[model samples]
Target: MYPFEITTPLTIDAAVQALQNEEAQPLAGGQTLIPTLKARLAMPEVLVSLTGIKELQSIAERDGQLCVGAGVTHANLAKQTAQYPALAALAVDIGDPAVRNRGTIGGSLANNDPAACYPAAALASAATIVTNARAIAADDYFLGMFETALDEGEIITEVRFPIPQAAYYAKFTQPASRFALVGVFVARFADAVRVAVTGASEEGVFRWLDAETALSQAFSAQALDGLTVPTEGMMDDIHGTPDYRAHLIAVLTKRAVIAAG
Candidate 1:
């Protein structure tokens, strides 16, 4: 890893100033950034650590919404019962305790690794990604595999989630890493339903439109019967075949529907 100057920014304005300069990166919990640096995938001239900014480390319940600061870590989420139980469940399914302790929501969404859990939660809850400049809806924030709408040097400030009526997350995890091989987050809105799928798509994350439509009509496990998941663009590595993953999507969606119900 290259040696870099580290600057601990005490305010968002200070952080933004550092980030707006060339080859400067904001350091959050360091779970992902540290590894990327060690792997030489990322080499920044300056690191503006956000941890010391107390405003970025808080979680608040306001106006019927749960607004979590971008710096909030998985370990903190796992231990908090005040969060929607479904989101907490999803947090528990992240990496091991050590990873959880260091992984931050902003870092996760900024990285947007295909198998990451935050994208699922953000999509399912229709959360807003608050950036230093503006707030982008989750659907608009995630552009593609490891891509986001955020501009260079723009740092995420917070993520705002409207409290759902009811929601649940179920993931078919890869044993060794505990990353989702296929994870489903099911949410119950007052009038409509939203189902977001992560982990089994070559396009990264997607909405199970059929399952979502089925649940909209009749929210039950049987509602998923006869649904055929398209096998196109799914991963086909040694982990599983495309057809195997397609089949799992249907089955897991049903189980999640039932469990969520």
Candidate 2:
């Protein structure tokens, strides 16, 4: 790993200020960041650790939403988010025990790995991504693969998920990394049904509008009988081809919808 200065800030303001320095980056759980550093893919001059900030560690429910702190670990989230069983179940299968204990929800969302699971949940739930600067809707937050709306020095403080009437996440995991080769999250609200697919698109996590429209009209697996996602922009990696991922997207979406029911 590259030589860098590590600073643990006790407050959000302090952490933000520290990140303003040249080549300084926010360090949450360090799951993705640490691995990148070891590979010399990232060489920051300073690592501003957000783990010490107490305000980023609380999980609560308020006004019909589940407010999850940015620093909440996968393990903790799996245990605490019983109110949103689908989300908690997603967290429970994130990685192995050690990775689950170390990886934070904020880290996962910020990194926005194309194959990551949380992005699907956030998008389907229409969750709000809260940062030190402002709150961004999940629809606007994710731009593309490994991209987000966050600006320099901005840090994710919390995420607010509007609890859905019913929801489910179905993932086709890549055996080695356990990252989703294709995963789908389906959420049914009072007035709408949202379906988000991850691990399939090259454009990153995206809503399957066709599926959403069909499921919104009738929330059931049978509603998606002929619906299919095009392979035009799907991911084509050694793990799976674009056609395979596209096929999985349809299959998983049906599975998720059935499970949600």
Candidate 3:
């Protein structure tokens, strides 16, 4: 890793101030950033560690929504988020024990890795991404591969997920990395249904509107019969082909719906 100064901030304001340096980067779980730094893929001059801030490590239900602190680790999320079973299940399956213990939801969403599991859940649940500057809707937060709508030096403080009537996340893992090769999150609401797809799209995580429309009418696996996602924009990598990922998108969506039921 490049020689850099690391700042441990005990509060959000201090962390935000530390990140004001143009070459400074926020360090949450370091699951992705550390590896990138070691490989010299990223060379930030300063690292503003957010873990020292106690306010960012909380998990609570507010009104009808689950308010999750960004610094909350995956293991803590999996254990503490029983109210949202689908989300807890997704957290439990994120990487392994070590990764779960070290990785933070804020870091995952901020990094916006196309294969990451949190984006699928956040998008499907229509959650809100609260940052130091403003609140961004999940639909507006994810821009593209490893990209987001966050401004420079903006810090994500919390994520607000509205409790769903029923929801499930189905992921087809790429065994070597444990990242989702093709993952689907299905959520049913009183007014509508939402289906989000990740790890399959070249453009990154996206809502499967066709499936959402179909599933909204009839929340069943059979409701997805004859439905197919175009392979044109699907990721084509050694682990899976574009066609294969597109196929898994459909299959997993069906499985998620069935399991959710």
Candidate 4:
């Protein structure tokens, strides 16, 4: 790691002010950022730790939604999955026990990793991202690979997921990294269905609208029998090809629907 000043701010205001420095970056679980520093991939002059901000570490119910603080670690979320089984299952399998202990939901979403699990759930559940500036709908939050709609020095306070009638998550992890080679999250409501796929697209996580429409009419694995996932813009890498990922998306979506039922 390069030389950098570490600032532990106790309040959101303090954290935001610290991030105003052009070279300062917010540090959460340090899962991705720390490694980047070690590899000299990133060299921010200041690391503003968000852990000390009390208001950013809460998990509670608010107005018919489950509000999860950005500072909540994956391990912490795993234990609470009984309330949100689909999300819990995804959290339990994130980067193993050690990584889970350190990775934060807010950090994961902010980083917007192409293969990250949280983005799938957030988008599938139609979750709301509450940031320091304003709330952003999940559909508008994720821009592209490792990108988001957050402005400079903006802080994500929490994420709010509305309770759904039924939901499930299915992930095909790359053996080495345990990151999703392709992950699907299916959230079904009384009137609408949402199917979000991650780790498959070149454009990052995106909703599979055709699958959603099919499932909305008949919520079952068989409902997707004739559906063909388009591969035009999917990621092609050493781990998987666009065709392979397109196949995985269908398989995982079916599995998730069956599991959700």
- Cα TM-score per model: 0.96, 0.99, 0.99, 0.98
lDDT of 1 at 55: 82
Encode model 4's per-residue lDDT on 1-261: one tens digit a residue. Answer: 568999999999899999999999999999998998999988999999998888987888788788999999999988865668788888999998999999999999999999999999999999999998899999999999999999989989999998789999999999999999999999998889999999999889999999999999999999999898988999998999999999999999999999999
Query: What residue pairs are clashing in model 3?
Result: none
Residue range 1-261, candidate 1, lDDT tens digits: 788999998999999998888888889989878988999998999999998888888888888788889888998876763658888888877988888888898899998877788898899888999999999998898888889999999999999988788888888898876888888888878887888888888877778888888998988888888998889998887887889888888877877778877
Q: After superposition, how far is residue 41 of candidate 1 from its true place, in Å?
A: 1.5
Measured by C-alpha RMSD in angstroms, how accurate is candidate 3? Answer: 0.6
Candidate 2 scores a C-alpha RMSD against the true structure in Å of 0.6
- Name the 10 consecutive residues with the lowest summed lDDT in model 3: 1-10
Candidate 3, residues 1-261: lDDT per residue as tens digits?
568999999999999998999999999999999999999999999999998999999999998899999999999999999899999999999999999999999999999999999999999999999999899999999999999999999999999999999999999999999999999999999999999999999889999999999999999999999999999989998999999999999999999999999
lDDT per residue (tens digit) for residues 163-235 in model 2: 9999999999898999998999999999999999999888899999999999988898899999888899998
lDDT of 2: 0.94
Q: Can you tell me which runs of candidate 3 are displaced by over 4 Å?
A: none
Candidate 1, residue 101: CA error in Å?
1.2
Residue 128 shift from truth in candidate 1, angstroms: 0.8
Model 4 / residue 26 / CA error / Å: 0.3
* Model 3 Cα shift for residue 153 (angstroms): 0.2
Q: How far off is residue 219 in model 1, in Å?
A: 0.8
Model 4 lDDT, residue 221, Cα = 94
